[model samples]
Target chain A: MSIIIKSSDDILPSEITDQKVFEGRREFIKKIGFGSAALLTGGHISLSHAKTAAGKYSDLPKSAFSAADKLTDFSDVSGYNNFYEFGTSKYDPAQKAKSFNSDPWSVAIEGEVEKPGVFNLEDFIKPYALEERIYRFRCVEGWSMVIPWVGFPLADMIKQFKPTSKAKYVEFVTLYDTKRMPGQVLKVLPWPYTEGLRIDEAMNPLTLMAVGLYGNDLPNQNGAPIRLVVPWKYGFKSIKSIVKIRFTEHQPLSTWNKIGPKEYGFYSNVNPQVDHPRWSQKTERKIGEPFWAPKHDTQIFNGYAEQVAHLYAGMDLKKNF
Target chain B: MDTVINSNKYSSSLYNPALIKPAVFILCLLPLMNLVWNGFNQGLGVNPAETIIRTLGDWALYILLFTLAVTPLRKIAGLTALIRVRRMLGLIMFFYASLHLLAYVWFDQYFDWNEIVKDIIKRPFITLGFATFILLIPLVLTSTNKMMKRLKRRWKTLHQMIYPISLMAVVHYFWMTRADFRQPVIIAIILSGLLAYRLFVYFKKQQSI
Candidate 1:
């Protein structure tokens, strides 16, 4: 269940955008004085205004992997979140995480990695150029959204960390602070949410280490500073506000799986056939659609099966899920 | 019994069913009216279907609890006129419950009977909710004055099903909740209090006999 290495000729020309050219175009837009105005004109007027108010991540090149589907409204994406770190309700994160401080964040990289050290978020993300990858995000709760996530591939970051041969899996942990994240005061879930992926899955080109969304630095509710974005897996597998990364030899315990092993599986891939214990995953309500709109039939691996199916080939998805 | 009857007559005269019944009916209708206003105003949030279904279900449970509370409140507070509005409240609870089920069927399942049947059979929470809705049918049918007069003693025994129906609704809610049990737990506690009051009255009656 591994991908075959392809020669340079096998790659599509559209997939090979020159980073310098992209950055040059962005610089030209900024020089022309339309950069901020262009961002301010779209459906996300409030979001763009907020970004300008904060003045963060103004120049990001769009990625080749960006989805062609219509993007979910920025307000819906930001407002309706399942960040248990803030609270259990969907609206709680946006309301409660307004004052959360994500500044001076550092991620401690340890276990089976050659260059194991605590790297400041700025230093960690400085090496790679950020791009906007609009991805289809499917939640285990049977709702889906297409999000424009800004980050580089997790594979690029992994190569720099230099994980040893003993590293069979990569585990990520979210920041744990009772004062900043009031929801942590309750033991709703074990504090400091955790998620993991197989070494191959972590190195998948589709796996992103997101730092921003909608051309702005990540909002506090959407896991400010840094987060993982595994497009094929359920949204929870993409742990947010990560403060720790550990390359381990065994499969790590994820927060949701730990809470309800039978319901939330370790490999939470999007499969219509494998329904959640309490609800059917066969269909998903696209956020921001009219109430009368029919549900979209959920696709296998959220329509990323062509890219990720090889990783789980010959394995029982129903059992794993 | 004579004093209780005398108090009922006195309270009935004071409250005036003509005015109080209409007020209670309008009060019960306000939640539905608010939902309609929100629907027209784009106020149901991101997922309107989910919001409509959940809000309708919440109101149904609330009205169900309110209907159950009428007896205890009337007995304890000597507001016997409250009993006159109980039937209307019960019917309103049925209305919300029907809307909730319809939203799930039409918006969620898209009238796919196969999927709906499968959901009722496979999912325990759905089964409990569907069963609770079904149990309400007999009670609603026998609610009219003519049917009540004809059935008389049998009607009293049949209406007791509300107790179990309310309990099942709460259990359905508890099962569907993902993590936070605060909402369901609070409903369960209030339901327990209502049932406890009935039990206390039953034991007192038996002791007197």
Candidate 2:
């Protein structure tokens, strides 16, 4: 039920070891272990003191982006989830996602790739350097979460796939079925959620195909079994439960955009300027705090403009938004 | 309520309908537990406490609507077993709704009556929500078995207040989430249909004579 690949050529074993060894950051890592990743299921996610003490950020040494938002006002990472496939209730995925058989899950890299085939999750992603990117995820519902995600950037992965010149857009699709994903039964949303990225955006160093969050494999509520991680856009744009990754010249029709054309758009960037039909997007309240707690102002491009902003050069975000 | 509270009048016997009482009590505790867990884990994630309070408040209204439907369900299905469960469920509906109100009063306003009064007066959603919750007070006060016996012929007339309360709950839900009216609309339609069934049954009974 496992597929092993020997392509750790670009990434060194030292890097992996470094990520595992966070001795210098023991105190911070210890605090994070007990903090954002706290799930309510009586502790199904066990955090050994090892990962924290090993040499935490020494693993993700330098990147264009800043560290994970550690301000007290930053939202809780674990609970900001779009687990509709597991259930409509926010926490249902955390409870019911156990039934999902992800070890056997395989990711398909197709459509405009030179190496277009179905490779097992191990062979597809194991070779890449798993860097921890601290990302600010903004949901369309006007909530936000700052997650420390561990995965290779989407560009890095796409380069490995060797996408052809015809590939102008990248698309992601979740596993769609009634059995494992019981929430599909209720059809709270249109099934098999699909999202897309412009070619340059997908290839940006910041955009990621994350496997884990808070230094652990993603809990079901936060899109286990593989999902995209786009820090700048609203969380929905980073589609969850992905079973397919396709590269095409044509723009993909996003599920939410198709459902409600105005509310969700192709480039659903986190812009305080553009408000949702129902609620203001100016500010978001951090989780695990008081009801009347003051919200931190949401940053445009989720504060990644310095590194990733050029990708959207001359493109009117307001019109496209 | 204590004046009508029956002390050891009813026994744990075959005629008492044992399973129904426990189920109602269990259902009552579920929303409270849901609120507590959501609070502790910060499950709402965005404005955790506000979202938790709001979500629990919404659940209270829905449970209240569910409680109101029991009598109409009994009339429609022609089931006598459904009748015994109604009072217990009704009290729970009120209990959660009261907690929801208390959350708003204490946590949301810091027990500031001025703000609470202003919101109730100004916001249509809060107006209906608060009014519907207030309507539950009399119903809960009279929920005891002894009170049921004492009220006798008057019980049915008094309990009719649930119709307006359920209507206001639906309206409040609709007003809160303005975009997707589908959920609240479905609930409102069901509540209307359930009441219609009772009206139809009442007219049909007279027609049979």
The residue-by-residue lDDT of candidate 1 on A1-321, one tens digit each, is 232223445444433445554455456655655455545454553233223222355556667665656668778889999998899989999999999989899999999999999989899899997877878899998899988788999999999999999999999999999999999998889888999999999999899999988778898899888999998789999999999999999999999999999999999998888989788998998987777878888877877765777888778777877
RMSD of 2: 10.1
Model 2 Cα shift for residue A31 (angstroms):
16
lDDT of each: 0.85, 0.68
* lDDT for residue B117 in candidate 1, whole number 0-100: 97
In TM-score terms, candidate 2 sits at 0.66
Best prediction by DockQ:
1
Give the range of the ten consecutive residues with the poorest summed lDDT in model 1 chain B.
B9-18
Per-candidate Cα RMSD to the true structure, in Å, reads 4.9, 10.1
lDDT by residue (B1-209, candidate 2, tens digit) is 32123213333433233455676678678867876786677555545556656767767766766676777767565544556677777777777777778776765555657756866886677888888887888888888888889999898799888877787788778877623356777887878887787788889999999
